[model samples]
Target: MAERTRPRPAADGAARNWLGLPAALAFIALVLLVDLAAAAHAVLIGFLALAPLLAAAVDTPRRTAAAAATATLAAVVAGLPSQTLGSLDHLLRVAVVIAVSIAAMYVARARTGREERIRRMTEIVRVTQRAILRDVPERVGGVTLRARYVSAYQEAGVGGDLYEVVPGPDRLRIIIGDVCGKGLPAVQLAAAVIGAFRQSAIVRTRLEEVAADLDALVAREPASTHGVTFVTAVLLEIRGPRLRVMSCGHPRPLLCRAGGSLVPLGTGTPKRPLGLGGDRGRPDTHRWDPGDRLLLYTDGMIEARDAAGRFFPVQRLARALSADSPEEALDAVWEAVRRHAGGPPRDDVALLLLQRLTPEPDTGGCGGPCPG
Candidate 1:
């Protein structure tokens, strides 16, 4: 049987009105109880009764004006039965009070409008940022890709950390990297790295060649307005059931097998950072299998330190990757890292997971084998 679902609640304005009606009525009743023979005391009480009306202004200006007007009328009626001044004096007093209330309402309304505009502009900026560094889709060269990026600062659209996947004629090319700095300067460097990777990944046959291309680009571009910046990166290529990785001073990636074993790839020792014109090293390649997973990351992940000043160990991260799904595994790893950092990260973090898809039986036809 199909299950029925409940309708969603109405908009905030409608809900506010529904909840505020009773309070508005109660305010009017309380104002009526005040005796106006003592004009100073009565006027004080009457003005206090109108406080709810000012709060109501947050939702609708018309409602706020109506509430203010009602309160003023109640004040006048309350004064009528008492031994107050002549009718004209009473009317003048009411008019003056109402005028003040209206002015206050206008000020509140203007402030509210300004706040809304700022909120909307912030949302637009956030949307634009997401479009710029959009998420990479799964399934590049028959491998499943799962990735996550988190900014250390709240409401940040993009940060220094970056990764990209490119499917080329020869192999599936991937790059996981981090810029040296933060803010707009870091973002610009990250963009340059991504641009260089995309263009070179398709043309260059070797991972080292791609790294050389990126290094050259960074070295030639003008220093950011803030200062010169650089990035650490790892370039990867997946072909058939094998993976080739070239590291450029970035953290080494980990390999997890279908049977729950993990292997740390690349030389564990540190290398010269990219963009420094240092001597380059040869690329390293390894065999992979169906159901195996590859984990790529920026240093921010493993370098995260707990309150006890201990860094998050790579071995512990690998064990956490033995989850049912790539997303789950990545989430677990991030949560653990966040805890170790004692809270949010001080720098941007990026994590990329690639799962080798099981190959389907060949339905032979035509041409030579694919590139690489």
Candidate 2:
């Protein structure tokens, strides 16, 4: 029950108090007017019930019930001049109001209780997500790094897209993945995969060994996969002067060499996504020099569509390679993607970029950015 407790913010409570004042005043005004009416028709007396109903909008059920009692008392005292207390019509009108007020209080309490429960649950989910996802470090081991995760529209801001960086003594291994499907099920699988990768990435001697561990972990998950739990991912090992990559049916990462040149990495072939059976990712090593950048991302980057239904030009990232740092470069990529999509993305988006910073420009164009 405590887990379901959602405390209303002080600002919202303040707003309710301000609004409650007017509602309470409206009750008093209605009660006074009914008393002033010389010929109080039975119908005119029924309007007293409306006062308590208005109180339900802004006040707690207890306060609303108190206001209802006050209103009922006013109606009885005020109605004395127009009708005898012994009259059946007057007695019935009083009974009608008392019943309506009690009912209003009950309805208000039930509705408020349910809403508070939902608010509490949502808050818990947000806290849990932050703990699991963790923040990307601004700079690590002389390499500037930046990452971003965006949930799809009208969602809880948690998605199947997941990424993590495991920095070692002199090397850093990174994983960017997109779990199949969407919503809670997808998010759960994403967590499982990331958890496995994080635990094995630094400990496992080889990159393929890390991928194998993750694949076995996903295979054990209880997913209702119709043969495809698209566990697409890009795993990278970055050391002093080399970048070793292993792709598991994921999008090819972009490489930005010194002097603002960008090109796609790897041989550009689709390997089967992990968790579908054989997870084969041969080690592809690249000459990672100082002032070089590697951008890793999920499919959402390419899948985003504009207002005219045009796909976001991921190729446009090449033009943005001139950015000063990994953080600045990602900012440019995100802005471009947003502009291209014309608004929020239709799916979850994840972007991660790494920059090598040793001053010696090895812009010989082998592992350096080339024509995509």
Candidate 3:
């Protein structure tokens, strides 16, 4: 079944687009009436040139042209009683109106063309994001999984952050990483890392080998323009009751136990971030007990700052995950993070919540009761 994601409202609504034309027409009417009322002494008709320019900034090119025509006609009408048609001064005012309208039309065309190109590129970014950062399934290897990716760039819905879940016969391997930068190059590097993770996870039996493969891929990938490309990642392999973790210069995963204890897993100093040519060494082992929840996230979560420049409190995560379901838990944390930052995160954030479900007694199936 498809995940029921919320629909986002349009950034620029249709009603907003319609405002520019009506506003331009109203301005033209006001200026025409004032020019007539001034008894031809104060020539405000030339000021009608502002109408089309205003429309060109916010309205469609066709509407901008209409605004230009309306302004020129208004100028002609205002010039009638004063110069009485065909007069040099009256013709000069009309000529000025015409000249300004032509310039406005040119501006409208150029602005409209640039907007169209941006629209096309935004569509391309959406398609690429969908392909590269496909949604994670609801469940994987007997564990309920909930994932969310938030990009700082609203135009490009996805950025340098990435996460993936690769399921084996008895185990589940997961990776969450962040590339060094942003934009298309960052997205390309993120895609490469995810690709390498999926491939290495399948072939390599050990988590260290998988991390090594990713390190090699990021180190040699030509997409790195700065040449010092690095990716901070956390790799996990969960089989039976054992959970092994290897952190490469990434935040430690938080484990919320059934008894309400929060533990930060892994030990020793974290290995250097991938692309630094350092050995990944070995993964640390931990217990994956039933009714336990594991929270894996990027640095964006803890690094998010508020108006006072204070970082988000990491301890609040355990309370946030106390919701009834994994999905709701993720939503709670996401909302809290946004609230703490006072807006969207300044950097890309990727979160994965994995809950170990207690097995059913009757059929011994993974579909078991969830802990609060």
Q: What are the runs in model 3 whose C-alpha is more than 4 Å off?
A: 1-9, 36-42, 80-86, 223-227, 259-261, 360-372
Full ranking by TM-score: 3, 2, 1
Position 300, candidate 1: lDDT: 80
Give the distance in Å from residue 235's predicted Cα in candidate 3 to where it truly belongs: 0.3
Top-lDDT candidate index: 3
TM-score of each: 0.70, 0.73, 0.88
TM-score of 2: 0.73
lDDT of 2: 0.76
Report, for every candidate in turn, its global Cα lDDT versus the true structure.
Answer: 0.71, 0.76, 0.82
lDDT of 1 by residue, 65-159 (tens): 66666766766775556645346666666776577668756855776688678667656655644644556777766688887777665454467
Candidate 1: which stretches are off by over 4 Å?
1-120, 123-127, 153-156, 224-227, 303-314, 338-346, 359-372
User: For model 2, how does the per-residue alpha-carbon lDDT over 258-366 read when each residue is reduced to its tens digit?
Assistant: 7677777787576667786685756677776678888898888899998788888777787676686666777789888888888767888888878877644343546
lDDT of each residue in 62-110, candidate 3, tens digit only: 9999999999988887766675566676778778888998999999889
Could you tell which candidate, 1 or 2, scores higher by TM-score?
Answer: 2
Off by over 4 Å in 2: 1-98, 153-157, 224-228, 256-258, 279-281, 287-292, 317-332, 335-343, 360-372
